[model samples]
Target chain A: MRTIRFLLQKEFRQIFRNRAILLLIGVMPVMQLLILPLAANYEVKNINLSVVDHDRSAYAQKLITKVTASGYFKLRGYSASFKEELRKIESDESDLILEIPQGFERNLIREDQQQLFIAVNAINGVKANLGGAYLTSIIRNFNEEIRIELLPPGRFNPAPVIEITASNWYNPLMEYRFYMVPGILAILVTMIGGFLSALNIVKEKEFGTIEQINVTPIKKHHFILGKLIPFWVLGNVVFSLGLLVAWLIYGIIPVGSLLVLYCFLSVYLLAILGFGLLISTFCDTQQQAMFIMFFFMMVFILMGGLFTSIDSMPDWAKLVSRFNPVSYLIEVMRMVILKGSGWKEIWPQFGIIALFAVFLNTYAIINYKKTS
Target chain B: MENLYAIELRNITKTYGREKQVAVDAVSFHVNKGELFGLIGPDGAGKTSIFRILTTLLLAEQGEAWVEGLEVKKDYREIRKIVGYMPGKFSLYPDLTVAENLDFFATVFDTTVAENYELIKEIYVQIEPFKTRRAGKLSGGMKQKLALCCALIHKPRVLFLDEPTTGVDPVSRKEFWEMLKKLKMQGISIIVSTPYMDEASLCDRIALIQHGRILSVDTPENMTGNYPGQLYAVKADQMYLLLKSLRKYPEVLDCYAFGAHAHVSFKNAFEAAPLKAYLRGEGLSEIEMKPIPASIEDYFIKLLKT
Candidate 1:
């Protein structure tokens, strides 16, 4: 414990002394919380749309009016030919295009069926799929209105009937802040473990003070544990500070136990620190450590189920996320803060994190050596 | 009085890598208690490797070492408590203030600065003006003093410094050795390693190491005294050509340039006046010839040649 205190003091002194590290730890969280949410949104708005009209009839005009009235698509431009419209789609100047066939009013009256063409960009597979679905729904509503208005006496039942209402939960308003803040919190908390610990050991290696520690009476585990405590405590402080800001700036209140969130956070922090210590043992330079940390940071954050729902991922991808500690922590944070979950509800996730903590820490301690 | 032997090694050998590059061969030497011992060698002579093994930071592949009567491997923890190690480079928390660094090291050994306050007071007082300054911000000499103070904070029975004055100015190097002398007076066993030949005289005994092997181990005075050949200092108007010309002489055993003069040894008994006359005949003018006492460097070169 004395060794731990010594190492803790050493690490804290280093972190506090480096202004750049301090800024990364304290100010970065708020900046990410504010900027990333506004920029990284799943619900795409302000979609630009182009229209090509061949019939130029009242029916085609009414169809365009209905598409514009729905407010899902903004008519940004009008094209004279299908060539021009297709060119617009190819160039990505517009997200979607609407086309009306010639004699559309005559066809609807004579054959009781008319075809409307819609083209959309599919690069962002999810957004494209959603846009296609929304466009179909708008056309379906217009067809139903035409049926009720044009054919009053005849009971043909031409307009196919099916109703589906989409609902969003947790963040029913679909605010990006609600989706992003918890995930960024998880990332920052884990970074505290990996980056700080790796840098600390690498700094010692550079300064040659590691030999001083090695020649001391302190056991290897004592030395490692001492280094872990200060960063662990600092991670928690940052976690709590993030929570405080969420409440004060955005009025986000936890629906679950803060203690459970902290417990999972602590376990995740240890696992990250253990992984970092393991990294430090293998790396000899601070530049190498930073590069390794950057690689792992990219993997963990991307796999944390932050941008896309883990449930929506394929089975293999979802299965892979189980190995990512950040994935478990994100779920635990959301469960505790959003669902107000208790120990019984989150015990399984907490167990995985505990195992990760124990496994990584054991691996780190076993692999770590006092000397090169 | 305490036992004369402060440290002992038996066939200590350490090999690095899976391929086993021998860093320290089957080498053995000991330093008496309170003796200022130096392991003098050039770079890559395995001086730091030896210290690492003795301090228990690294374990040798073969052989044994003991410090203060405790086996290095078996009693490593106890040895750690009784040894102070300052590596070849400045190895302190650069971000921490000088005082914070001192306090941290002292705390690691379960000791307080106040307890060893008297021991480190001399070194620490010099760096006290920069107590609040970060260690990285201090000058090289200041950093050197701070490292020494931290090393002595635990007041260990033995001090292991690995080329502690390598890059410092010459005056600071002189001052550092003077500080080591004061600590020696206080009964600390010191083992310092250096490549500086001038520092050999500062130690009671030194082992000249090369290529993971010991060339010689004796008192500086004794090592210089045992030069096998009669060496003469020779210089002429063209010293380079003079050295080259002397090397071609059948009577000359070894002729190597040292500073402004050439240290020439003869194959058999020869006189200095004849060598001067011989040089004059070989287009040399204003020759200076004299026999002088051998220095440690001369002995080192002779040892290398033999």
Candidate 2:
């Protein structure tokens, strides 16, 4: 224990003394939390739409106004020629084109329906699909308005109409940042914990200081524990800072017990830091460790269900994400913060992370040899 | 049986790589209780390999080693407690202050600098002024001094220094030797390795090693005193031609440049008059030749040839 204390003291002293890394520790989480959530927004806006109105009627003009007023589309061009709008979609000036066929307000009243055409660019699939969906819904609302006006003034037209009501719970406004904050916070904490611990031992190896330590009476586990503790503390500090940023910048507060968040956080840090140590044991230099950590970090972040839902992934990918520690932490963060869940809700994830922590740390300890 | 030697290695062999290069092969040596022993060899003579095996940082494939009577393999935990090791490279944490590095190692051994200050004082006081400076900021000699101080902080029964003076300045090298001599007086058995042949004479005993083998192990004085051939230091204005002429002589067994003179060894005896007369016949003047004692380097050169 005394040896571990000294080791921690030395390790912490080194970590804080490096001004560049100190700057990194202070600024990286603040910058990532504040910047990434706003930039990684899932709700796509500013889609370009071109409208070609050939009808030149009162309702056709209203349809154009309704599409622009929905705020999902930007009316880049409004023209009476279909050739001009087709050129707009072809030149990538517009994501979609809504064309109303040549008719008076006559067709809907006389034949009960009229044909409208929506040609989407479909080059950028998400933006195109979302733009098409928004235009379709707005036209459906317009159709309802026309049908109501044409109805014979409470003459009891017998048509079965279903009225659907939707209310957004948890995030009533459905602010994208609120969903993103905790997930991004989980990732930022994961990066700091994983990279720092991975570099700790390998830096000693590069500097040839491990040879000096190997000859000492310090137990292998004591040395490993020393490495684990200082970085664990740093991970916690970054996590807390991220939380503060979340609450301050995005106005997000965890509705669940703070104890549950911290409990999972402490265990998550252990599992990720253990994984870093395991990599540290396998590498001989900081560069090797960094590359290995980067490769794993890439895999962890992509498959971690932050940007994409785990359930939406293919069967093989979902099976693979089951082993990613970051995914569980992200789930736990969302469950506890958004759902106001307590220990009862997060216990299963907690058990998996604790198991990961024990297995990785034990393997690293056994793999670390004082003698070759 | 009670172990008589402070350290021992018997028929130790270590091989590396897929091609299996032998680093230390069937090598055996010992050190006395308080003697300052030297492993005198050049850079790749397997000196560092031997230190690693005994320090429990590496394993020898074929044989056995014991430190303070404990097997290096079985009793490594106890052995680590009783030995201090300074590797060929400077291994202290560069970002940590000198004081921190020393204190860290001291704490690691479950001791304090004050407990072993006497063992390292002769070297420590010189570097104490810069204790707050990071170790990487120190000069080469100062870094070496700091490394030595850290290694000695635990007051081990035995200290292993592998080529401690390889890159140090000459004056600092002398001072380092002086420090080692003082530590010997404090009853700490020291086994230091060096490539400098001149430094070999300063140790109580040294094992001359080459190519993963020990050529000889004995007191420096006795090793030179038992010279088997007549050696001479020959000087000439045309030194290169003198070397060729000397090697051409059938009676000359060995001839090579050594400092300002060409050293030529003879099988049985050396007479300067015959060599001088021969040099004159070969159209050389101002030739000087005289019999001199062989040095550890000469002995090593002769061993390599045989």
Candidate 3:
């Protein structure tokens, strides 16, 4: 315990003395939290649309007006021919183009049906797909209106239909920011905890101080704890700062108990810090340690289900994500903050994190060699 | 089961890399309690390797070592408590002030600065004026003093200092040796290594090592006293040419350039007149010659030749 106190004192002094790193730790995460959620939105809006109306009939004009008025697209311009509309798409001026054949109103009254063509730019697959779906729904609504007008109101009655009213739970309006803020907060904590402690011992090795420390009477467990606790504390400090930013900038206060969130954070930080120390023990230089940490953080963040739902991933990816510690924290954060889950609801996740804390830390302690 | 020595090593060998480069060969030596022993060698002479083994910072692949009557491999925990090590480089926390480094090391050994003040007082007082300065900002000499102070704060039974005075100035080097003398009086056994040949005389005994092997081990007096032949110092107007001429002489057993003069040893004792005649015949002028006592450096060169 006494040895750990001295080691902690030295570590804290070194950390605070480096003003540039202190600023990076304090400001970078908050900035990322405030700006990233706004940019990482999945809601596609304001799609650019173009029309090549060859018909010039009342029904075609009405359809064009209805598509523009649906609020899912912006009209680039009206082209006289399909070739001109293709030119608009090639020039990057439009994302979707609609064409209506000539005699559309006569054909709709005489044969009771007509077909329209939609040429969607498939370069950005998601945008094109969603845009096409929105335009189809609008056209369907217009067709239903036409049918109702031609039926003379009460003369013919349609078959019975069931109305489906859908509601989004947890995020009533489906605000992407609410779902993203908690996940981003988890990433921030992981970055601070993992990178800093990962470089701790390797920095000592570079400076030649590890030789002095290794020759001392300090126990391996004592040294490991000394390294783990400081970064663990700093990780929590970053977590709290992120939470404050979430509340102040996005108005996202956790709906669950604050105690429960903190409880999970404390254990999660330990597992991550231990993993960092484990890397430090294996690497001989600071550069090696930094690169290795970068590799793992990249894997953990992309597969951790922060931006995408894990359920939508392939079977193999889902199985791989089960091993990522960040995945568990993201799940816990979203569950507690978005769903307002209780201890009983999150106990299983808590158990896995607690196991990681024990296993990773023990591995680090056992692998840390006093004599080589 | 008698433990008369503070440290002992038996046939210690260590190799590194896939090619198995031999760093320290099958070497063995011992230091008695409170004795000042020196390992004198140049940079790659394996002095650091031996110190690391005894200090429990490295493992020897083929041998055994004991510190303070405890095996270095098995009793490391107990050994660490009683031994202090100062590596060749200044390894203290550079961002930390001198006082903080000292306090930290002292606390790590479960003692306070005040408790062992007397042991490090003579050395600490010199750097105490700049106690608040970061260790990295101190001069080379002051850094050495601060490192010594940190090592001595625990009052260990044995202290290992590896090349403690290699880069220090002359005055600081003198002061460091004086401080080591004081620590010796306190009954603390000290083992120090240095590449500086002059520092070997300050030790009670030294092991002259080269190429990872012990060439000779003895007191400074005995090592120099055992020179096999008479030595002569010869200098002339053209020193480089004089050295070549001396090496070409049929009677000269060995010849090496030492500073301003060429130290020449002969197969047998001969008068300086014939040597001077030979040099003058080679167009040398203003030649001066004398017989000087062999120093540790002379003995080292002589051992290397064999």
Candidate 4:
């Protein structure tokens, strides 16, 4: 314990002594949190639509008005020819084209049926899908209105309409930042903790100081704990700072117990730091450690359900996320910060992360041998 | 019997990587209690490899080593407790201040600097004024002094220094040897390695190593005293022509350039007068020739060739 105290003291002195690293630790997360959520907005809007009206009918004008009025799309151009409007799609001036067939109103009244065509640019698949879904729903609503106007008053309809009124639980306002802030806090802590500790031991290797430490009588675990504790403490400081940023910028406070939140963070920091140390032991230089950490951070964050929901992933990808410690933190952050979840709600995830901490730390210590 | 040998290695060999390059080959040597021993060789001669094996930072593939009577492979933990190793590289945390570096190392071995202050006081006092300065900001000599102080902070029974004077200035190197002598007087057996042959003379005994093998292990005086040749230092105005003529001389056994002079080792029948006369006859002016005792460098070169 005394040895750990001294090691902690030394580590802190080195950390504070490096001015560039100090600024990086202080500035990086705040910048990322403030900028990424605002730009990474998932709600798609302002899709450009072009219309080719061969009929020039009143109903065709009404349809265009209704599509523009829905607030999901902007009518970019109108042309008499289909090819001209297709040219609009090719030039990147518009994302979709709607064509009204000739005699469309005569066909709807005489034959009680009509055909409309929508050509969607599928380059940005999410935007294209949402735009197509919105246009289809609008047309369905228009068809229902025309059917109601044509129905005889005495002739009763037998079919029932099922409607769904979605009430977004936990985040009633559905503010993307409210959902993103907690997850972003998870990423913030993971990155600062992982990158710092990942570079720590490998820096010693590059400087050749580990050779000095390895020759000493210090126990292997004691030395690893010495490396672990300082980062764990720093991880907490960064976590608290992130929490303060979240509360100040987004007006978000955890609905769960603060003690429970801290409890999870403490264990999560250990797991992540252990992972960093594990990466360091496998690498011989800071450059190698940085690249390897970057690769893993990429994998962890992308699959961590931070940007994409894990539930929607294929079986293999979902299996991969099961091993990602970052996912659990993102999940626990949402559960605690947004859902008002207590200890009972997060116990399973808590147990899994605790296991991760133990497994990773023990493996790291065992892999770090003083003697070749 | 075990107490007499501070460190011992026998038939130790190490091979590196898939290239199968030999680092230390079947090498054997020992350091006596309180003796200042040096492994004298040029770079890539496996001096650092030997030190690493003895320090337990590396494993010897074929031989056994012991430090303070504890086996290296089996009792490494015990060996680590009893020995102090300073690698060729400056291994202290550069961002850390001098005092912090020393104190951190002191704490690592579970002993405070106060407990071993008397042992390092002689060297530490020289660097004391800069205790608050970061280690990387220190001069090369000062960095070496601080490294030595940190290595000695734990007061181990044996010390392994790998080229402690390689880049240090001459005056600092002399002071460093003086410090080693004082530590030897305090009964700490030292095993120091150096590529500089001049530094070999200060060690109580040295093992001249080359190509992962030990060539000779003896006192510096005896190693030079036992040099087998009639040695002569020959200098002339036309040094290159003189060198060409000396190599072709009948009795000239081996000759090589040594600084500004051609150091030639001749057979027993060879004489200084004949070489001097031969140089003059070859149109070389202002020729100088004299027999001088072989230094460790001369012996090291001879050993490397033969």
Which lDDT value does model 2 have at A25?
81
| lDDT for position A316 in model 1 | 88
> Per-residue alpha-carbon lDDT of model 4 for A1-372, expressed as tens digits?
898888888888888988887777788778888888887787778999999998889888888899999999999999889898889889999999999999988898788899999999999899899999999999988887777777776663667768789999889988999889889889989998999889999999999999999998888898899899988988888788888888888889888888999999999999999999999998999999999999999999999999999999999999999999999999999999988899999999999999999999999999997878
Consecutive 10-residue window with the lowest summed lDDT within model 3 chain B: B1-10
Candidate 1 Cα errors over 4 Å, as ranges: A1-3, A153-162, A166-169, B1-4
* Model 1 per-residue lDDT tens digits across residues A152-193: 757757568577788987778877778677877788778876
lDDT of candidate 3 over A84-200, digit per residue (tens): 889999998999999888888889878989988899999998899999999998998999888887778786567886777999999999999999999998998998899999999
**Best candidate according to TM-score:** 4
Return the interface RMSD of model 1. Answer: 1.5
True contacts kept of 1: 0.88
Lowest lDDT 10-mer window, candidate 4 chain A?
Answer: A152-161
Worst 10 residues of 2 chain B by lDDT: B266-275
Residues forming the 10-long window of minimal summed lDDT in candidate 1 chain A? A37-46
Q: What is the lDDT of candidate 2?
A: 0.91
lDDT of 4 at A115: 98
- TM-score of each prediction: 0.94, 0.94, 0.95, 0.95
Report how far off residue A166 is in candidate 2 (Å): 1.6
Query: What is the per-residue lDDT of model 1 for residues B1-306, given as tens digits with 9 covering 90 to 100?
Result: 234578888789988999999999999999999999999999999999999999998989899888998888888888999999998888887878998989998998899999999888888888998899989899999998998988899999999999998999999999899999999999999999999999999999999998888889999999989988678888888988898889888899998999999998888997777777778888999888888888888899988888
Score chain A of model 2 by TM-score against the reference chain A: 0.95
lDDT tens readout by residue for model 2, A1-372: 788889889988998899987877889899988899999987879999898888889888988899899988899988899899999888889888888888846797799889899999988988888888888999999988887788877854587767898898988888888888999999999999999989989998999999999999899899999999998899989989999998888888899999889989999999999999999999999999999999999999999999999999999999999999999999999999998999888899999999999999999999998888
Report the C-alpha lDDT of model 3 over B1-306, residue by residue, as the tens digit.
Answer: 357799888899988789998889988888889999999998899999999989888899998888878998899999889998999999999999999999999999999999999999888999999999999999999999999999999999999999999878899899889999999999999999999999999999999998788888899999989998888898899988998899899999998999999898998876788988999999999999988899899999999988
